[model samples]
Target: MGASIPPPPPVITRSSDMDPHTLEQLRAVKEMLTAQEEEAQGLRDLNRDLRERLEDCETKIKKLNEQNDEYAEKEKVLSHRVAEKVRNNKQMSVVMEEYERTIS
Candidate 1:
């Protein structure tokens, strides 16, 4: 195999050697980056607020769901009791009819 050629040394340019136009472009890029950082911080704050609100909403939803379950159970119990009362009333009416017929 042929020996690998070494890479050329990187040409180093000092900040003082940078042309005025290149320096201006660099300064513009730095300003843009600073603005982006500020915008990112604002987004982070907004995200934190939204997260807190979402958590609160979730908690409220959970509480409401639990309350709904409790109410459903209570309704079921009430419905069962009402049905039992209706059946008892029907039986009592049948008994009364039989008694009246015997009396006649």
Candidate 2:
């Protein structure tokens, strides 16, 4: 949140002695109000920009997570294929040994 605005200056009465300084005081107060308003607006703009960046980051994370899941599934399929190949090789080795025994 931005800085809180100060309470407005006390209302000036039309007494003769205080009359001279009233206009000066009014001008000073007006300038202060303007400055505060500008600061608050700048903070609002910064907040909005940060929110947009966070949303972009979240979207990117979602895409990467989905890609990772696909890779994991592919790895499972390849592992099964390798296991099957190893079993087939063992069976062939046993058969070759039996054939040599018969020939000898």
Candidate 3:
């Protein structure tokens, strides 16, 4: 934890002050606290990893959107070119028809 839990109240200075059962209880409490600390650390690590992945995904999505925009622009340009070609072909056909009529 950010602020360590003080270290478990130090070992009993003398055996006379506390009974065996109390000492056992203290040891069990210490073990439980240690387990909780380890679990908390694991959760923190997992959170950090997930944040990194999310950032990576956001970057990829940005790049894909840029590519899609580029494709749309290219499609627009190509469509305009096709329309121009159709108009030009029609004008050519009209000119050829006039020439044929005059010759006949």
**Please, what are the lDDT tens digits per residue for candidate 2 over residues 60-86?**
999999999999999999999999999
Ranking by TM-score: 1, 3, 2
RMSD to the hidden true structure, all candidates: 4.2, 9.4, 8.4
Model 2 gets an lDDT of: 0.89
- Output the better candidate (2/3) by lDDT: 3
Lowest lDDT block of 10, candidate 3: 3-12
Candidate 3 global Cα RMSD: 8.4
Tens digit per residue, CA lDDT, model 3, 1-104: 48766666766688677898988998899999999999999999999999999999999999999999999999999999999999999999999999999999
Task: Report the lDDT tens digits of candidate 1 across residue range 33-55.
Answer: 99999999999999999999999
Worst-scoring 10-residue span by lDDT in model 2:
11-20
Which residue pairs of candidate 1 clash? none
Q: lDDT for each of the candidates?
A: 0.96, 0.89, 0.94
Candidate 2 positional error at 83, Å = 1.4
Order of models, best lDDT first: 1, 3, 2
Better of 1 and 3 by lDDT: 1
Error of 1 at 85 (Å): 1.0
